[model samples]
Target chain A: MSYCVNCGVELDRTAACCALCGTEVCNPSQPVDMTAPKPFPEEMQPPPPNNRPLIAGLLAALLSLPVLVCLVTNLVFGGGAWSVYPIGGIVLFWVLTAGPLLSRKPRPVPLIALDAFAVLVYLFVIAALGGQGLIVGLHWYLRLALPIVVVVAAATLFPVAYLRRYRADGLVTSAILFVDAGLALVGIELALSFFAGHPFQLSWSWIVLISCLAMSVALLIIDRSPHLLAELRRRLHV
Target chain B: MSPLRKKSRPATAYAEWFKLDNAAKLYPAIHTGKRASMFRISAVLAEPVRPELLQAALEEVLPRFPAYAVRLHSGLFWHYFGHAPGCPRVLPDIKNPMLRPRFREKPGFLFRVFHYERRIAVEFFHALADASGVLVFLKTLVAAYLARAGGPGVAPGRLPETVYGPGLLDPAATPDPEEFEDAFLRYAHLHGPQGYREPKAYHFASTPEPIHTLHMVLGLVPVDRLLEAARRRKVTITEYLAAVYVDTLLEMQRREREVLHVDPRRRPLPVRLQVPVNLRRFFPTKSLRNFSFFVNVSIDAANGDYAFDEILPLVHHRMRLGLDKRTLAASIGQNVKPERSLALRLTPLFLKNLAIAEIYRRVGEPTSSGAMSNLGEVEMPPELADAVERFEFSLGPSFRIRTNVAMASYKGTLAITFSSTCKETDLERGFLTRLVRDGIPVKVESNR
Candidate 1:
């Protein structure tokens, strides 16, 4: 056996250098052994669970149980066909929470639109069950809830689309958000007024519109002029 | 799975499907199309490779390795392996070969076999197997090719041949059940005491080259000279090489400290090396799957500066302690315990993947300065061995750890190949130069 000159420990025949230090072995009297078996094993082998897939498929099945229970309870306990509302609500909830998990690449825009569509469908079902029928109930639902939900979706979606397409910074994104809020508020007021059979007059919307306009103008200035924006940011601790 | 056909093969051609082993579960969870945990083991022959014969050999030898005939599949709680529909096709090697082989790109295969001039390369996604397993596959493929192409001496019984003929690869040979076992789980004590904790280790810093382009530095060292060097050092070759790596890392840290003008009071980070222990050595299993775990062999720079001589014995001791059966079992228990937890078992695959990736970032590379996977010596039957010139093993570049060193010896040549995604070559240069300084003969080759 050859001893390590540096550490005074015995070396393995297959060793090329000291395991402890970075010292190389050099021995004239003791030659390196080449015929010994290596310390490691040479052979290799083929190196479990069905319940997993069943559980995933069961997720849809399990989630549907709550909707089923609510439907039966509403129809049995109550006189009117009010079960449609809770059933629609549960279905909409599932679409929002679990639908994205199914997709390879779930973006925000399409998912948000899907959420809005689910809510609209739910409202139409409620109108049809609680009101006259699909014909007259849907007419009222389209006039009121459809316009309101569409405007709300547009308000959330428009800014997202703009920000994504332009790759906007915080200042630009905030400005767009503020401007869209004002427009959505105006749209809500217009839809309510027209459905309510009253003249469209901006009341709560006016205050929101002015404040949003001011914030949008300030953000636009900050985005365009870097110097004043830095000063304002420092002074306001923003 | 599409019912419609494109280039569909006959149903009988597909091989048996198998599940990913316990150690392999992490790879499939974390692998993306761009960043996969993969490695390559290649054999360079004395003569240039013929693509047609190599393809035929691949076809011949594939039936012998039923475990490798798999593709990734999504299950409810975990990802799994399913039998791919067709046989893997051999192709001419690409310019840069270790880029993640997407399941779609390879048309459902998890591994690729490539031939370029004199070299035959097998690149595997870690989900398929480890370095040792790849070496076996490469040797068997090469052996089969030589017999068919009339190139060299054919070792009749040594090659994997079917009962019917030489062209059919082990058609009747049943896959050993032990080959597919999770040796870690089988050997580990369910309630065993946990292993030691790892202190944050020093990491080499460098500006990375372009993504997916790992620079390979292959140092061809004569086995005789290296064996002599280790003998004089009075340590195993693995221990000696690990010490050299630690020394090089320490030097780099000192330079960084001087350049950055860092405070002297700040404790020096530990220089730790993650040395993989093949579980097959400890457990009586012949698994060709991932059956290995690494122990962090370290030098505590916090204890103060360590001279090369001082660090040598410490590394030798650490390696011994780290490889002890109980120590390995305890470490394996720690990993397997988490895997077997009821909470973790119940978790959905996607969410578990996210959690696993985060845990790896926090606990994986931080515990080690670098990884040194010594595949030791690859011994083939004398007749097949005579035709092969060299064998090379390389760990693919990792995101957190920029450089990983892998070495395999064949035909009296120890080819230590270092793969790094970083632009810096300081560690490799320093280590090789140290060997040369110690009178060990080393010839270097690089793909920069």
Candidate 2:
């Protein structure tokens, strides 16, 4: 038994330094004591996230402005409806603000609702305007519904299925993040098609195809290789 | 003919073993500098060393200092060891000095020869020996030889003792292993720069720091004043100086954090310090060519402020913990192995280039904000001190780390010095200034 001279703390024979104060314990003639004061672990907390709700609300507002402007112009010049546009914009912003919170899992319910809302607003605004009249053919519905169906269904079912079906692997998490990025891109394309009114969309299809292809490749390649999966887990953080 | 290659029949060999730390591979471009370097410290005892009796003295000394007597056989078959083990020493030199060291060239044997200089010139091969072990080995070897040569003339009535180099070198006969071992190890580790940049110079044949880069400034503090200071602090002289370095680095880190807004709380920064311990307590090796290995001691930067009051006992405690005879003896046994290459897959290219860095990582990538090597309590045969004047140490920049603080004492005064390969970082400014500011009276000298 000994005491640290610097801190005056009673210590075990093996103490390298004072455990509390980091004062070196100088016991020369003692037996080897296994319990030496060792260094503490050094994992630092990340800097506090600058999470600002005001900034979030402002971002939501900014996104809603352009859609509102287009809707207003349609009402005046192209005989579009005034009421549906503002209401849809409010609902879309609400989803943008609370998508992660409201979805028990990533249901994509908000995105689907927004996609439908955008189509309805575009048709009503343009029908009132009487420029290119509101026409919702089966092809248009197929284009709009297919992506919404895949995203909403996948978002709702993937987590539950993945938990039950896929084996626990490191790469699975990052694979999921990329998959969400692909779905978000699909949502953007759908929203764009609604505003344009006349959809002669050939080239945009490639972007959707590429995003899905990349997400699948990232998943399949990462899943199969253990070494690569470890690498991905270490880097991707997701 | 060449300065580094010797004129002897059996060429002197030095082999450095670079074991990786935590089995981790290094990324490219990391600066792995030296943990410490060879203090440009030369002890000028009263008399100049005699050249005439050198070989005869070596014959008497070789059987005694076992650590200095062994020949190195590395894993690199053609370059170091023979095609088979323990082959005769008549191997031809077919190696190109210009080519970078490869796995075939690894398990390096640093050939050392104490020839053709008023002071013994130890010509070292690239991969084998570090500066501290080699320098102490050189000093001990020559001192032992001198002791033997001046037999009755110098040895007085002492027996032909070759069992331990440090023991024989000490005329005072204080067999307190506890007190001296720490001093020896501190001295050994302090011989090079504090830290070196790794990955940057990860080749065995990579250029060492410019020899001129290491410089010294010496001053005299009477033996009594130093002794008083040591007594006042209830610490040894080595402990007092070690405190200064620990404090210096701590202060430097503190100041840097304050100025640069570095969050010390993030991951407590490390400023590990290593000091070389000479293994003269257990046995004597006569050659004195490679006599010491380092005992490392480190203090985290955030632990406390740099104050002598806090630092003194800290130094004493670390020294006491590390220099226990059993630990030291085991360490010596572990380090004094005849050279052999590690069995492995393909040799990592980094290992070939970064000899010191690779070794540093193995030796616990000492995250010393700096190092302090104080070669304490050196005894100059009374007649030699008059001719030699004083001693101070200098070392090459190490692998991975950046700065070092080195000192050695003679005639009771300690010379404190710093060296760095980094032209940019201000490692020496704050702490060294503190020493002078607190009235320690540091005299500054540098090659720059």
- RMSD per candidate (Å) reads 15.5, 22.7
- Candidate 2 stretches with Cα past 4 Å from truth are A1-238, B1-223, B263-265, B282-293, B303-306, B329-363, B424-432, B437-439
DockQ of each: 0.03, 0.01
Q: Which candidate has the highest TM-score of all?
A: 1
> Chain B TM-score in candidate 2, rounded to 2 decimals?
0.56
Q: Sort candidate 1 into its docking category.
A: incorrect
The candidate 2 chain B region of ten consecutive residues with least summed lDDT is: B90-99
Predicted candidate 1 versus true structure: per-residue lDDT over B115-186, tens digit per residue: 777888999999888877667778778877877664455543435433222212243356555555556667
Best by DockQ: 1
lDDT of 2 by residue, A151-209 (tens): 55556455546655665534566666556656666665664566366553444755765
Summarize candidate 2's per-residue lDDT along B1-448 as a digit string, tens digits: 0111212222222212222211112211123221222223344334434554555444443333223333323333222222211211211111111111122233322233332223333333222333444455446555555555443245523334443344244432322222212122222221222342311111111133432232222233345565676787798867766676666666655665677675543334555667766555444432233345455656654455555687677778988887876565545433322122353223544444365355556544444444566656555544433434455554445554555566666666665545554543244545444444444443332333
Clashes of each: 25, 88
